[model samples]
Target: SDYSQEPPRHPALLVNSKEPFNAEPHRSALVTSYVTPVEFFYKRNHGPVPIVDDIDKFSVSITGLIENPKELCMKDILRLPKYAVTATLQCAGNRRTAMSKTRKVKGVGWDIAAIGNAIWGGAKLADVLELIGIPKFSYISPCGGKHVEFVSIDKCKEENGGPYKASIPLSQATNPEADILLAYEMNGETLNRDHGYPLRVIVPGVIGARSVKWLDSINIIAKECQGLFTQKDYKMFPPSVNWDNIDWSTRRPQMDFPIQSAICSLDDVNNLKPGKITIKGYAVSGGGRGIERVEVSIDGGKTWVEASKYQKAGVPYISDDESCDKWAWVLFEAEADVPESTEIVAKAVDIAGNVQPENVEVIWNLRGILNTSWHRVHVQIGR
Candidate 1:
């Protein structure tokens, strides 16, 4: 309800909505680098950003179904271990604008830029849980803790103006390899207000909703958080399911995102001089899967050419590399000769062999989430 607390954002960002601020960078800016700058990173907020001016007084309460409930302050967290991770976060509605063209869908309209990669610095949740006597990989204990719910400080209408909240399986929360973090920094700098300031949860390889911002409290619960975003929204529904016949219970909350890619070098429609053209984009998959291959087609989908993929500059991306940032995205590029007007399309295959669907119509849902359909751009060749 308070608009004065929101922080200033970059002027280049394409503002999708004013209230509950949601905006993203231009598609071309996304592929300029592997690690997205904080200023260019997509912003997705449910409500007005909460302000936490006093770092000393900020604390996150660990409660619910636990024998040793503890309140961790900034000093307590900093005393433990610190780790930095490079990960990408993509909203479920990243390509909602394109999806809505097929049929009207609910939620904010977003272009293809609602995704970004950044290096997050913070304490591991597993290590933090250990301080409370919860061992690694522990799921349901005698106290009945099966899910780890994260509650944010910001209030949103979705939860009846309650704090935005979500949860993850306790198993994932306790797994050190999962790389979940109670993050306090982004892109090597203290997190800005636009992002979760002071602290926030970072659940790598999952949908962005689970990464609650504006650190509030953590709850070890027996079931998933019954927040509106978790229970009613973000769940994938078939095209057949409409508002009148919708059954939220039929589907579970979406976690990992599907394989996705988009041609960022060009807009949805462009006019260019006929000659050698360079195409660039980004590709990523969920659950820590690496991108195996990225293909580009200039003549629609009839013929395709393998595009080069890389995560770091001058370093070719190898999906199985031990040092590779599995949770981040790879930029793909290729060169093609164009003498006539044609449609350009890009698709990717992950290490697990997951490929983007060819069309958006089949995957269309009421919420227009996870539109990982093949990305296409129509280019007019000019003399």
Candidate 2:
């Protein structure tokens, strides 16, 4: 059975791009409950999945501006102490559909499903860098001047480039709070080929594109990655900018997702025998600032109500100690008296005073990113 060809069985999935790659997820999966299982998690890929047969032979190379360029085999990397984190990976284009609604955009028409939460286990990037004599503070000092570039093992001969590569600012790469990982395992098992086998980079709090798959090499530099993924694509621009007038260099690569949230439930229009309808969803902010609160609005953003709150997803250690962890998502819920109306709308706010926009038009960009507007659902009210 080629599991790769199988379609996802989740009922709530909203399909976006489909081909050698498919991006989708249960719209309400994030807040319907905590702990999104590996199977139900969203999948995003830039190319066909590569098949790897030998884990022992696989190795990762660290090069560029480092004092000692080192190549470590998978077996050696496993010898070090391992840590686990429950982090969410969201594609920069997660809500492309919301942008398309306003005007035509240029890439995969992703819905909210391009995001997923996972419990990743691997050696901390800082610990590894320390072994190679890379100073922890060097990332922060502008004088040291280093950028960490991630190169995927997956390769293809493209008309314009060699393979997909992405980079993050050195400060983000070395932050202990970032919890960056040379991940060999996902959801407790070895990574699937589509997910990057042998090794991959898991960069928490950044867009998914930066977390390159099929890990091969890490290079330190004084400038941002010039690859297509980092420079020519995955950026945000004013909604007024069109394809003909786009100035790629004027835009910066996206990092640190903005404060965002969505509604996960609605009244069953067909069976409208409801006393009350409950709203549930997840809210999160990037750059390690935990979600402070989630507020729900029933009538488009005119009136607001507070939702019940809980810890972010994939946090297994939260049960043991809460203080050690500072970031993730906050699940929320609110119940509203269902009026005999045609539709219900919901929006949420995060800790940093950032609230979802009232409508998509106000925040819509040409690339279809940062679509954190109110999510609406239509339902009939009858017995």
Candidate 3:
């Protein structure tokens, strides 16, 4: 019953779970700013948050596939180059409740606000590894590995009854421009206990699961993460599959999330007043792909209207003249006049031409991990 070490959360958050806390802010209250306040940021935890005693003395072990298998204290990591990355962390289950409507799925049912944007400041994961120095040797060195695994301090029963762990491809981890961070701070302040106090892996443009928190060790392995999450979950399946005939092996784990956008305004249909109503929300594309357009269709997908766009100040995910990287999200707003009743829907198109499917049936899976289908909200339009 005692979650004192879990960090104080905003009372306004809609409680999803208590022990391994999982909650999200009311959608309307969360869209006032481009940067989500950490307190109101959605909390998704799979296990008990470990109580860290000494943050400054916190150490992380780097082992396997590298010449210098050394330990890095907090001080050692800070000495590396510091970089700032603005990104949005969305649980793979964001909007699972919507998918649950079509058919029952076994997972946390998160609404639209299950995603939040934050400014992460820390040493580049690549730079820190460079300082440690990977031995100049063949790929088949003594402990040659193709993936970088991050093991968190939090103990969870779901993951083989051990600490939670996840991994990214070595190529992605080694790329300087990959923008991966050994983040210690969030929104210009020290990370809250609930958000990984001492350290966490900030894997931009990827699912939040990949960003392991309370990072205790880094393992380089020749194979992808064998963690239960990587192996048995976060995957997509066909509509026909059920528990009896399910085969997780046939499907690959979800890495980069596809194009996603949501309507964060107007929580209830009865709350609608009348006439033309202005709606606001956020949109994001994965894998550094930018949102080229966000279209809102109050009359279902038959007709659409372009939404005015906004991105985090100072950081532009997409730019002109020269090339810049995009791992963050873009906020948007659209105004429309409504009548009696209607289905308000919005879909996003990323720069890569990825569009959200018009309906959930085509994208529906058993677990509802990646519900990137067009986000919709039915409203009995008021007078």
Which candidate number would show the highest TM-score if scored against the true structure?
1
Query: 233-316 in candidate 1: lDDT tens per residue?
Result: 999999899999998988889999999999999999999999999999999999999998999999998999999999889999
lDDT of 2 at 182: 82
Ranking of models by TM-score: 1, 3, 2
lDDT of 1 at 379: 94
> Following a full C-alpha superposition, what root-mean-square deviation does model 2 have from the true structure?
3.7
Q: Residue 363 deviation, candidate 2, in Å? A: 1.9
RMSD of each: 1.7, 3.7, 3.0
Q: Could you give candidate 3's per-residue lDDT for residues 292-334 as a string of tens digits?
A: 8899998877899988777744454443313443777788888
Ten-residue stretch with the least lDDT total in model 1? 137-146
- TM-score of each candidate structure, all chains considered together: 0.98, 0.89, 0.93
lDDT of 2 by residue, 262-363 (tens): 666542233465468777766666766666556666565567777776664444222124552444566667788767754566665555667677778887
User: Candidate 3: misplaced stretches above 4 Å?
Assistant: 1-4, 135-145, 312-325
What lDDT is obtained when candidate 3 is compared to the true structure? 0.83
Ranking of models by lDDT = 1, 3, 2
CA lDDT of every candidate: 0.93, 0.71, 0.83
Q: Candidate 1 vs. truth: CA RMSD? A: 1.7
